[model samples]
Target: MELFQNVVKLRGFLGRNADVPPSDGITEDAYTILHLATMSGTWDIATNDWKPRIDWHRIICPGPWFCGFTRGMRRGEYLEIEGELRDFEQDRTVVVVGKRYPAKHLSYTVHATRIQQLERPLLVVDTGDDG
Candidate 1:
């Protein structure tokens, strides 16, 4: 299956669970910002065409809402992710495109923990190539 399809499936699964921890609760304003970011994917600096990059971290994670969540986390509360943008798919929901680091990295563990805590299906797409 495609990355976006997997994300949608995950979201559906998360929606069914009641014990999942909320990820700082998404606000209407945050949602609006996300919408805008998604729309701005048409401007390509290199190609100069309206081709959207499928990298969610670049398109969505930099928004005020995501930044707020990252900032709100206490020290050592969550793992820090650092990687390059890969791809994204906008089918019903947005799916992030990136790759996780080595198992020794705290970011990987933190991401796994966060995914478990999510009340809604939050898809973190990995390219299976960690380098």
Candidate 2:
């Protein structure tokens, strides 16, 4: 078995239709981008009410295979995705008043290994107990 693992599984809905940007002449650069959203609820003791939270995720699939399939997917379409979390670093140079400055930005994205569309979502039950 492996000693280290970086796996992420997310079940959520599509925020919008999938997009495939123009390839940058690199074979491995061909990929699709998907916006996914998930929800979580918690009972607030102080407010004595339930609070809902929504989390958005950026998903990247490395291939042109899923383009057609995901292109037709509409917003709020339920999906289950399995992948690993990846971090990307981007560098840029800026020029201001004849001076040059370098900048670096870091971003996190989920690299999907598998994706499936679920016809129906599991039911969520609300228990009155604050426990």
Candidate 3:
């Protein structure tokens, strides 16, 4: 019996191009990073309407083959991704009023095993007439 499992499936639009670094190290050749955005709506009681919220995610593509597959993908493309969540502690410096403080933050990244492109973004054409 397996008590622990980390799996996630999401469909969203690509926010930017995949980040692929030069294959200088063994680990570098095995993974690439992608930024994706997912949108969800929630009811706003004050406005009596639904409000849309966007959530951004960082995805890590494993394997050189998969990295190659994502390298050609462009922004504004819709995609479906399947992966496991990976979380780590990241240290950063925060500055406030010329004062610097060290902080530790927990960051989560998706390690993708499968990815599929759904559709490309639509293009709008303008006709110069306003009626």
Which stretches of candidate 3 lie above 4 Å from their native place? 22-28, 120-131
Encode model 1's per-residue lDDT on 1-131: one tens digit a residue: 55542121111111111121244654543421111111135677798666754322221333334544443333112122322323433334333576443332121101111121123235597777989
Instruction: Judging by TM-score against the true structure, name the best candidate.
Output: 3
What lDDT does candidate 1 reach at residue 59?
Answer: 18
Q: In candidate 1, which residue pairs clash?
A: 54-87, 54-88, 55-87
Model 1 spans with C-alpha error above 4 angstroms: 3-60, 79-131
Better of 2 and 3 by lDDT: 3
TM per prediction: 0.19, 0.74, 0.79
Q: Flag clash pairs in model 3.
A: none
Error of 3 at 90 (Å): 1.4
lDDT of 3 by residue, 19-90 (tens): 876656426447888999999989989989879999999999988777678877788889999999999998
Candidate 2 C-alpha lDDT tens digits along 37-101: 99999999999988999999999988666654565677878999999999999998888999999
lDDT of 2: 0.85
Considering every candidate listed, which one attains the maximal lDDT? 3
Alpha-carbon shift of residue 19 in model 2 (angstroms) = 0.6
Model 2 scores a TM of 0.74
Shift in Å, residue 56, candidate 1? 19
Backbone clash total, candidate 1 = 3
Q: Lowest-lDDT window of 10 residues in candidate 2?
A: 20-29
